[model samples]
Target: MPVLDKFNMVSQGAAGNLCWACVGWSVARYYDNRAGVPPRWSTLCEYVMKAADFLDGISPESTRCCDGERLLDPDCNQSRILPDAFRVSSNQGSVRERALSFQEIKTEIDAGRPVGVEVESSSAGSRAIAIYGYDDSESQKVMVGDPAPDAPDGALIPYDELCFGYRHSDATWNHSYLTVP
Candidate 1:
């Protein structure tokens, strides 16, 4: 059930906003592990950003460093784009939900699915990260694949700290997460 080892953390770089880059990386990891087809993170990121631009008439540049609110919008939602991006059947769709509990996240990880989440960082503002595993031996922590340039792959972060930051963020979509089912 542990999937952290299956994933490779890819940095977002200047390709797009953290939101789209994380989405791209998460989705790419999902397919890479599930199908053994490795998709480029930059290609997936561009696909997502271009889809947003086409649907919402917003320039891709405007999407750079976007907050979660913009990401959750109907036109820009990853749930809406994932099917097309990967050409999956409509029934096997992605979901974006608010305030998912730690247990919910654990359940998904146990199922071997990586989750995309928006967490507020005090110094870095809001960014999206992919959750791949969890540890509850002592203090509960989740294994995260962050898309930040300097972030190492498979970093363990305290679950409580992530929850607190997500809950306290100003964005309405603060505690929201995306899952492909």
Candidate 2:
């Protein structure tokens, strides 16, 4: 389970990819051990959005409208999604505050679970990343699978910086993140 690399590494391939929901399903699939050849990027994006439809009582097809960089209004309720295998849920709290502790995140990663996190993006709105492992040597950082990566292996965010960035304040909810179950 050390730095679980079997999880599918994906890049948001289109201008309107839903990073929030994409990472949600990605972590879920990874936890379920279903990291085979993934569906097309667009198809997987749509699937994740549909899986999150129970939150807003919306049709699966209607999620296509959520094409912006930010998460959909009210955000995708991670608890509402009934993943084919795992029982998915989020850290209970509003998106405006910190939802998980570093140890909580590390515990999941130690179990070979990938957790989803939302961070402010320099390009568009906030972006989502799938965190796989932690490095607590000289500097503390987490190995992440950033869908918006400019290159491979994604990138690493300093643990403190990641905690700060996860606290977001926008027109929508303040704190928004999805955790691996």
Candidate 3:
């Protein structure tokens, strides 16, 4: 779970779920070779929310659904935002998304790239996690940065459990997986 040694992980604190997504973006940009100095967390979050059409520029610190546009937009400059890095192909929905497989997720981690995850939450509607490391063999666990104020930066979850929870059929979690570049 300690694989993310080089990522510039940030906590959302009281900023809310949207802020978590920004943390993911910031991590991605931090790894982008073209990016300059990392921007403030708020700046990254605001930019993402704006792209998602959240015009008010606010982090509600509460559960809410976000427009998927910002996270999935292939045209988005990965060097600047909390949006995910997905490999695009001609397919639909999860099928297209699955191109970045679990092994690829591990490869990204090995290469110092942080992964972005989207998980369902009953209280918060939708939530995001920044994945920095994974125990691929011994425990099959992942190290994640939870943006919630009460959660610590490096929390652990079973790799299979997290992946299973991500499925829409899972009662506790709806979606899970790292979108890699």
Each model's lDDT? 0.57, 0.52, 0.50
Please tell me which model should have the higher TM-score, number 1 or number 2.
Answer: 1
Tens-digit lDDT string for candidate 3 (53-162) = 34233343331322332233323222322333221110011222322455766877886666666665454456666667888677667777766667777777776666
Query: Best candidate per lDDT, number?
Result: 1
Lowest summed lDDT across 10 adjacent residues in model 1 is found at: 82-91
lDDT of 1 by residue, 7-97 (tens): 6666655434544445554566556667676543334445556556655577878766234323433344344422333332111235554
Better model by lDDT: candidate 1 vs candidate 2: 1
C-alpha RMSD in Å of predicted model 3 compared with the true structure: 9.3
lDDT of 3 at 143: 79
Error of 1 at 52 (Å): 5.6
Q: Residue by residue across 14-126, what tens digits does model 2's lDDT show?
A: 53344555565566556445435443334443545555554546676655534544345434323222122122224222232443566766777776666655555443565
